[model samples]
Target: MIRLRAHHLLCLLTYVGRGYTPAFVAQYSAIVARLNAGEGAVLVEGPDDICAPMLDSGHHCREPRITTRDALAREAVAAALGQSLAPGDTIPLDGPTIARLRENFAAGTIRAACAACQWDGLCSGIAASGFSRTRLSGAPV
Candidate 1:
């Protein structure tokens, strides 16, 4: 099933097919299978390496792949996903959800999630640059 941390899913929105190993693409296929099923995807806020296989794709640039078991992290992730997700909520990682995220990101609604991200500076730069870039390195977009 396609399960992921909120930020990882966020990263996928801008994925332009770079930096991933072939194996990761296979894994991604499976994830997509679930996401396409509307209710087969899972979202979490703690201790799950949902994005591990694809983190090296550079879309995320070492930003956290798993949310931490903390109130702030959970809250931020929930804000990002636009739902009150717990550690194992079945969510739809489909177009509408992702589209909402994209709009929210452009409109500054997902800043809370960015607050919990290590890539905050890079994300800020992306936002500042009017989202001219999505695949960023840790070096400030």
Candidate 2:
């Protein structure tokens, strides 16, 4: 199973093979490929698979602001999925679920955690474009 922080669940929706560094993007792309291939994901508290590459570089995965973003993402995602999402909880990445999240994201209902994120504009543009050209696949059209 892929281990991911709460905020990453939102990030995956608009991922288009870009990240902080080449290694980070490589790792994230691999993770997205796994998810697209039907892999499952478990919610984690801090640095997860995606953060592995950046961990050795003194990344800010443990910062208070980042943690706060995770908390907000957890709450928003939990509400969106109508399920309690805590650390160690399994998240379903099915097409329907992804579509639902994308819909909410586009409508701005599940974007509270994105307010302070650097990729907010990019993600917003992706959502506005109906998630076209995103790396993720297998969702119903």
Candidate 3:
């Protein structure tokens, strides 16, 4: 299973082969491929697989603001999916599920956690463009 922070579930909706570093992009791209191939995702509190590449660089994965973002993301996503999600909860990255999440993301209903995120504008652009060129499979074509 791929380990991911709750906020990453929102991030995946707009990933377009860009990231903080080449290694970060590469790692995230590979994770997206795995998710496309039907990998399961396990929710993690902080510093998940995607954050591994940045850990050595003193990344802010452990910061309080990021932790709060995670909590907000978890709450919003759980409400969107109508499921209770915890740190250890496993989420299936299936086509329908991804589609549903993307729909909610584009509608701005599940975006409270993204308010303070640096990539919010980028994500909003992606959503506005109908998720075009996003790496995630099962996105609207």
Candidate 4:
């Protein structure tokens, strides 16, 4: 289960698996493994090893990260909407505010977790096309 932000949820919706490096792919595959059971979403939670962090530029994926981006997500969203996601458990990527989040991202208010991801453009394109309408292949959210 990978904990995710609006950015990651959108990226996975448009992901075609070509931009990241082999190391990144290998690391990502570990997360993909969880999808076999058909459990995937922007926000997810699973067994320890399978529950990958929202992989960011901060991750080289060669070692354990001493810090997590939970605060970054809280700050970004709270700064934008004055409320933060609790994400108590795995959350499938489906909601009414997908477009609102996208708009915030474009305005630079909802960008912390995604500022460094290479898939930024793709996610933006997907969002631009209408985030609430976009859907991932494996799950409704």
Q: Would you list the C-alpha lDDT of every candidate in the order shown? A: 0.52, 0.90, 0.90, 0.47
Task: List, residue by residue over 1-141, the lDDT tens digit for candidate 4.
Answer: 454533343344444443456755555455544553456444322222322343555444333221233445445655555554555535443333444455676665666666566667876776566544333334233
lDDT of 3 by residue, 45-115 (tens): 99899899999899888999899889999998999899999999998677788888999999998898898
Candidate 2 steric clashes: 0
Residue-level lDDT for 125 in candidate 2: 90
Per-candidate TM-scores read 0.53, 0.95, 0.95, 0.44
Tell me the TM-score of model 2.
Answer: 0.95
Tell me the lDDT of candidate 3.
Answer: 0.90
User: Which regions of candidate 1 are displaced past 4 Å?
Assistant: 20-22, 37-39, 45-77, 80-82, 112-141
Clash totals, every prediction: 0, 0, 0, 1
For model 4, state the Cα shift of residue 108 in Å.
2.7
